[model samples]
Target chain A: MNQEQFEIYRHLAGRLIDGQLSPGSHIESEQELARKFSTTRMNAYRAIKQLERRGIVSRSKRAGTRVSAPVNPNLLRQLKCEMTRRICVIHSRNSYEYLHWTGEFRRTLQQALAAEDFTLEDVHLDDVRDRAELKEKLLRLTETGIAAFILSVRGEEDEFLIENSDLFFQYHNKIFVYQSGAMSWMHWPFHTVTVNIFGEGSLAAKYLMEKGIRKIAYCRREISSKNYLDFNRERLLGVEFTMRRLSDGRNKPEEWVGLEQIYRNCMENGSGCGLIVSTDELAARIIDYFAERGAKRPPEMISFDNNSEYDSYRLTTIAPPHVEMAQTLGRLIFDNIDIDSECGFVSYIKIDSKLIINHQE
Target chain B: MNQEQFEIYRHLAGRLIDGQLSPGSHIESEQELARKFSTTRMNAYRAIKQLERRGIVSRSKRAGTRVSAPVNPNLLRQLKCEMTRRICVIHSRNSYEYLHWTGEFRRTLQQALAAEDFTLEDVHLDDVRDRAELKEKLLRLTETGIAAFILSVRGEEDEFLIENSDLFFQYHNKIFVYQSGAMSWMHWPFHTVTVNIFGEGSLAAKYLMEKGIRKIAYCRREISSKNYLDFNRERLLGVEFTMRRLSDGRNKPEEWVGLEQIYRNCMENGSGCGLIVSTDELAARIIDYFAERGAKRPPEMISFDNNSEYDSYRLTTIAPPHVEMAQTLGRLIFDNIDIDSECGFVSYIKIDSKLIINHQE
Candidate 1:
């Protein structure tokens, strides 16, 4: 798409030739690489997606992007099998407990690797932020013969790294990201763990309607995320669809309550309200708030699970199949499917949530 | 006391002097080492306990054994500081998510640590049967320059480790374990986050008595834990104390109800009953089980909290302070206290629990 992206592709291809980037290894996210090269997320995504299309990597929603397995003999035949390939795992400090599932996953991975006589060196970096620090760490990994990396990047900071995919490629390292949607602006070869946000939203709406709730409110945080916005639009559409089915040409409702406006409305009204909370934790908090303030509870409140260990509110929620998702991702990484090929690839995987009704609200 | 213990102490002292052992690192449990070394739990406990008495290590209920912080050569040259240099953290992971306010305490610990520039590394080994894998991982950490470890050991496994502390110490590690009265027989400490079972049980009993429930059934899981047994015994004592104060030395109740048996008895007799379930999960399960089976609901039921995330049951529960505990433990670790000293040590820290009354009990 651009000179920088082309350069990145060249460098990445060179690494594949030199065996520096091996099969079944995970690369850094587009955001991480963009930051490293001081560029845009668009460019970075372009470079990576191109590589992916070339069968260099495989991507999924929960597993992020990873190097395809089945070694390309022309690329790695010269390297020793026991060189102790180093891999870096970067995660936010606050997410330590939530990510503990990784520990168990890692153990299982290690055992699997050991069975095949492959040695792995893992380096865990916690509370990582700042582009310079990230670059320094990546450089260190390279200096120490690190073959690949796994990162969970957060926020808008990813944009910078996406633009610099060419620079990353020049260094003979592959980069991958864990995103849930198509980056229409970028044509680079990269992999991602994409979720069916639209479908999930529709399901939420349908579930609420089934409970005999006509007046509904949707609550979400103020943060801007493409995934969140996509889900919101889809959920609204689903609600409208259900409403239209029931109304028989009746007039549409005039007001839609936002999260900030929920408390006032809840306090003012006694009943006949249904709420679809964006996340379970938030729903719990809202329930607790209402309880403390002596407000009448809603007839039905639905929430989405985000792998939290504690729920602040006693409510009915839809839980994601986290374990199943984790396992599927693990299998994909272990298998190392070709990114370019559509044959035998799982294009989409959607999980359903169950209704767990509690007594509190 | 025994040959194995004598050797363990000898090895422990060597590790301390060599700087291979660090302050606040957890050692193997008495039962664990004993099994590994083909010795008895008492032998292992005696050795570690002897070291503890000599100011070489520090031990507590669930916290496991740990090497006291060594005096900094620089500090030693200046002036003597009387501070206890050991750090201890006691944690409990039980399915009883509704019990004892454990989760709340953990959060408090996290907040406290956040105020400082330190982070906690948690490795949750859900079951003790994975000890060999745990040991391997621990050894790998040591190789990767991790100086201390915290863990929770369970069952007869405590004796094996304590008896074989010599081998463990030689590997350059320390441990702390929680202990409470005669129940030391259940000492299976790797490194634990302990709870005040006796105190909490007594409080629960007192609260129920105040609510006018004289014939209360203690509903517990089929496979009980040491904490459960301890809490039940203490609660019984408290209930007895309260009854003594209220009665004129005439009425004495002999029958107590276990969870399963209570259901059968109630069904056969059509009697109204009040219940105190061991943990929240169990309580929720009991409710679900009855509702599904078309059994009449109990009049009143109370349960303990381990701060579980599932709120599907929403029964009345005693909420633990897990957040606080996690925060506290994080701070203690960051402070870098010396475990070898007895002076200036806080013997025990207990947080109060609150009752959250919900319907559908």
Candidate 2:
């Protein structure tokens, strides 16, 4: 139930899964493991006991302890087969707790993978109380064989991968990160599944432009917070690329136009401008904002991220297909799991988003 | 019934899956599509009609024809959820027929993915009767969105990947291949799931050595027939690396030694030599060969591949864990399916085999 038990248990189990701890091999005693992990002896013993419950280890009073031999290939297979493999989303405690967007993504991701019998849990493994706890969780996550992670690493953890790539690579191939629209490509070197914001952005622009809206505007989220804005700029870059291609570079949407000004200008002029907001939430907000302003109607609008909130608008949005992404993500991850060692090139698959005129997740 | 219908169907479905064919867009009429594909009109109509069956397209006398707009996201998901995802093993007809070994691997792979609801079949897409059919099947396999493949490339198909990598890359991230031990490294660039023949070879050497068999012998099948000999040399390299580490390598088994000579020397010397054969079949032949020579008993023996034939001896074998490999392959393939596009390098996971003492699968 506590972090200590979970940490110790996950790391040792990971070792077994990675073949780092061979079957029937003697392991560091519970006492030795506790000292090694700088945890209380009780935590280590509890961790091993958890492994025993999973048929990953065996213990006896007469003999000390060891990773149990695979009982029989058929039985070992059945034990593995009977269980559903878990995939967790590892995010900072703040992101999971405070951010509505992350929660939305988690819910959507779970819905996506649920069909495949994959359970996506919110894992606050990195949010331990202290350095020792964090160390234990990190070790457990990287070493324990229990589950794979969809790591949304922020701030220091990005630095952690750079500093400890080998220890990370020991279990690196097992985890996945989202492709972000961040300016810095720090996580570019690792395994990533991302929406092609650039391509989708451009494509959406072309599609919207063809609908005959003369004035086009771009909307954005407030960047006052520094937590996870990596994709913010990239999303715009995609939109601008499309604008530059279609129109004379003369009257482009100004950089970082606030929603208030955008709403005011379009309403005052009664110009049915084509608006590209950062998300479906913003799209709904603008429509509501116009209604609140006593305007009879709003401008032609489109948004990104097909969150379920936009279901009522019949709104046009440039949204990453979550279930399709999950399905593709499933296909991509499973495809490369076999070739990670031999193929050194990271494959950045471009997930194309569609311009949905109506409907939602 | 013919390759054209299959190709036309798979390719259009691929376009739908890839978003190239927008939902609710007017597609080429059956006559147009048939003309475009250089096929009979009936074939194209059948292909499009098949798409209609999948809820992808809708046809009527008044509406003409178009990609069906998903009436509801939940309903669309339900329709997709009803489908069975196919994972195929692509091979030449010659390879599938003459070599029964590939059948064993296919069975193991099926058993492994069976739990995940994936049915594995040997897809002879490459074995089409003619060159045009081969072209159609190859294009269909790579570009079609219907199924993922486990490509067992041999002779010409390896060259096929190099020649048409773009079309291959279009959907190359969707299939799987065995991690092979070929010295050329030609096949490593593609997606592969393979047994760690080298590592398993090394560990088997060490295990038999510890059990008191000093002089190690390596046995192999002939490469003249050109079947799946991916791990042929690497298996020996593993044992040799271990032998060199354990003792002087002056008397180690030479490469490609015929079974007759190896059987004669071990029987004549009575020096209790440990053996590593290519497979359980070769091991059975060796054991039976010894029996024909009037030896009192079989030498201390270990073999590769845990096919059920080795069961009676409780034969120690160096065979890659088919089910274990399957388990790992499932995890590996599923793990990387989501991340292949983000990761730059192809992941070749090193699959570890075990020293099975008293059983066989």
Put down candidate 2 lDDT per residue, A101-125, tens digits, no spaces: 2554556666656654567656664
Docking class of 1: incorrect
Candidates' DockQ values?
0.01, 0.02
- Report the lDDT tens digits of candidate 2 across residue range B299-339: 57677666675577567775554455455557655544431
The runs of at least 3 residues in candidate 2 whose Cα sits more than 4 Å from the true structure, single-residue gaps closed, are: A1-361, B1-87, B92-122, B125-133, B140-145, B153-173, B179-188, B222-230, B248-256, B310-314, B332-343, B359-361
Backbone clashes in candidate 2 total: 52
Q: lDDT scores for all predictions?
A: 0.48, 0.56
Q: Write the per-residue lDDT of candidate 1 for residues A1-87, one digit (tens) a residue.
A: 455665555555556656677876777788886887788888778877876865678888888888885454412321211122344
Off by over 4 Å in 1: A1-87, A92-129, A153-176, A179-188, A224-260, A267-270, A306-309, A337-355, A359-361, B1-361
Q: Summarize candidate 1's per-residue lDDT along B1-361 as a digit string, tens digits.
A: 3346655655655555457777887777888878877888887887787667655578888787887757344222111211112222312343222233334544565466556432445554354344465456444444433323333333112333333332232233234333221123221212233444433444555566666766666666655555445445654543443344333223222334555675775576454456767667677677767777788666677777633554766677776545544544454454333333222111122334456777663
**Model 2 RMSD, rounded to 1 decimal:** 16.4
**Where does the lowest 10-residue lDDT sum fall in candidate 2 chain B?**
B75-84
